[model samples]
Target: MGFATKKSKRWELQQLTWTFISIVMFVPLPVHIFPFVMLTQAKKGKIRSWYIAGIAFLLLELGLFASFVYFFGTISQAMLLTLTGSVTSYIIGNGLLLNRAKPYLQRLELAEIRPLAWIPTASSRNKIQQLPQAALDTPQLFIERLIHWRKEIDNRAIHQNIDKIIHLFQLLEQNDKMEAEKFLVRHATVVNVLMKYDEIENSRLYNSVTAESKKKLEDVIAKAAIAIEQEVTNQFKSGILDVSAETDVYIQSLKNRNLLNE
Candidate 1:
């Protein structure tokens, strides 16, 4: 969705990219930037209307192309066209970058949902909400529903990839130590690991995946939630996913599967 090639040092590809960025910045893209940023704001999250943004951006690009062809009909008008091109590039760039930050914001929101102890309950006291009846009816189906929640916080335009990946552990920590330690012992093996009892304040996952951004993000988070850094951050917990809270979700998920009561 993005490219950051260096400015031209005589190469045609670089030159072409530079020229394109210029033309695209000229008008519609720039004019759209303000509205686009405003549209991204949410009372609880960053914007997530990426499909709509993509469609609108496509139309804007088409209009710009058609206009360029029509108004710059004469080859001699190249200079004036270049000026217009620059403006177009600026607006488009702004819109796209703002859009990209939405996912990061979502990740931050997810990050905020830590142990109740870490979060002050003095304001809006959140509760140990019960499983929604809908989720209570089908465990497997809802278990995999991780993407939309990710999008709500991480919808590309919000947070950095590092922070997003860090979320897996935060969820893991809450799952194992804070809420689900017992359930995990019954339903899973990882929860019985000795490191599940500590109360870590900050989160720190492996940051070694420097080869590719996407690969790095997935690999680090997907790796087992065990490490000296994670151990320290978790307040030296003894295990992975706690069996108690794990059991609650497991049972609920099973109830969701028609196995037990909600």
Candidate 2:
């Protein structure tokens, strides 16, 4: 099995084990809340596992109940416990399943909508070991960290931001703002690198980028982030910019004006 599939199966086993325990204890009280939560989350698969465990418990309880009644001539308090436990197990098991699935579900939805395109690819093994220790501003530092950890980042949102940043550079180049285009391209390379790190693993290089340094770097990027913003405003004022055009179309238009170096 794939790593993800194995991990998921392990998680399911854990959940089943706990659900079984709750069943034996006659306190699947979470059933009252988790079922409704599962419904709202719309993740029914997880709830199905809970039902599997609950049903198994119910079957076992029925066999035991029959034995007790046959020997003792009465359906004892165990019957009451079984009835209540069964009800709560189903309800709460659903809720627990949905709750556990929430983050994965949200990320899956986002991945569907934001199709991956033209993300610069490089291996973390190629990362440079040492960086110059000279004084550098926040944007430069942030970009440097990106370059240093280029192989470590793997977040979709960061790549999306890089896409926008690339588009902005193309826009600047089209507007004869070659200097700004070059500046951002040089600085934002790290942003792209950091964004493309492995999603499921911790990046040692990424972890090394300190928070205080990141905050300062963010401030710098924000201030000089996209010089194309001003150029876009100018184009709009001059009636030269097509506001309705999709970003890709505009990028194509700019590329047609000048060849973008790979």
Candidate 3:
């Protein structure tokens, strides 16, 4: 019953499910369930779902070809049948799946999980160049980055702080876009700290020094969250926007952190 244990079990179950699908796809002319299963997985934001789908499709085709050859007792006849079936299935199945998964695929492209420390400078340069300049300074980009980072980081406190920060930015985007941009500009160090923290976390060299650096980074992110909450409250008090009920939760959190006077 720990959260991590539950997450691990869930992930294992998913892998097992995929494995079962692959086995089923290997059966001769198996039911076309893999494509539907693939679309479901892709919609859930699983990055490698397409890869699994492609491999399973190939297995399915191979099984069909083998079975056809065995039944017909002729390579030429089997080739013809296999070719027609596979090409037709590929065209129809993938067309529908791709159409349905387009939005999820685009979102995944925006926040592609990257190993900051492991990527070579030359390789990363191309990736950096591909991003829009406006996106670099946007709260949405940072939120996506933090979401991906949460998947890699194991600390629950860091996860909670990240969630809070994400919520604050979302509220700012909805209530006041100008204020959200100003907050990002004012707290530019938040971006730098996050980049440095990611580098250290992915370095895979856990030592006392790295541990201390991580602790400091966690504190920085927590403080940054507090600052963001304060900015939202300031916006509310200045008549820029009415204070929503959710803002009350943020104010309570800040007070719990002892950053706001009771």
Candidate 4:
């Protein structure tokens, strides 16, 4: 089997083991352990919805246990409770997953609609040539191409930075995350508007695009580009300053130990 298939099978086995423990034990201890495992998996972006339902089921079971020292009931009653609780938890988990899946599907659709110009390969030039002109002219494509033009930096670093920003946004469901998402949504809207304008100009509706509309679109693109450049410059400057300071401290320490000449 492929490595990815093997890894996925392993995860499936782990989840099954925990689930069996939770159901067979019919106790809060095994139930709680499964939820914690699911939560860790969710944080790693594996299973997204099970943790919340598992946690709810665990808490309910714990409350029942607190009321009764042991499951002082008939075997049939215990089995009934386990079956009901497990079914309820499964329904709740599936419901939450469906809710999240909607936005996730929409995002995937949007990404497909605005495909990147650069493929991670030596054949990127041919791929770009094959794309429609509208895709080539998008602000997002422009930014991606510009970053790719910098041969000195590894492209993976850019992806890593983007992942870090995404991780930060995922850390909370509060106002900060909302505000950050709002800013990104607004930026994406602006870029899409510009891309649509470009498409119209390139299409048979070129005569319909008024000069004023064209000017406004150009202005928006220019301002957005300037803002992006400034942000990148600031980040690079900050990194350089930090490195310089650290280097100076190291040099001073070496001089103090007579390990280096003035």
Task: Note the Cα lDDT for every prediction shown.
Answer: 0.36, 0.42, 0.59, 0.44
Candidate number of the best TM-score: 3
What does candidate 4 score on TM? 0.31
Give the Å error, residue 35, model 3: 4.1
lDDT for model 2, please. 0.42
lDDT of 3 by residue, 1-262 (tens): 1222213445444434643553345333444555555545444544454546646666675676666666675568666877678666656555545343333333433333321221222224335533434335656546555665665566788788777877777777777788778866776566566667777878998899999999999899899888888987777676644445568889999999999997
- Per-residue CA lDDT of model 1 for 1-262, tens digit only, reads 1121112233423323423443444454323342333233222232245435544655565665666666665655664765566466556655554444434333233334531122222111112111122222221111212322222232232223323324543455454544333322322322111111111101223344322443433334334333423543564353434656687787788888898765
Error of 4 at 103 (Å): 6.5
Candidate 4 achieves a global lDDT of 0.44
Task: For model 3, name the residue pairs that clash.
Answer: none
TM-score of 1: 0.25
RMSD of 3: 11.8
TM-score-best of 1 and 2: 2
Q: What is the TM-score of each candidate against the true structure?
A: 0.25, 0.26, 0.51, 0.31
Q: Candidate 2 at 176: error in angstroms?
A: 24
RMSD of candidate 1 to the truth, in angstroms, is: 17.1
Q: In model 2, how large is the Cα lDDT of residue 229?
A: 58
Using lDDT as the yardstick, the better of models 2 and 4 is 4
**Model 3 misplaced regions, further than 4 Å:** 1-31, 35-77, 80-135, 202-212, 239-262
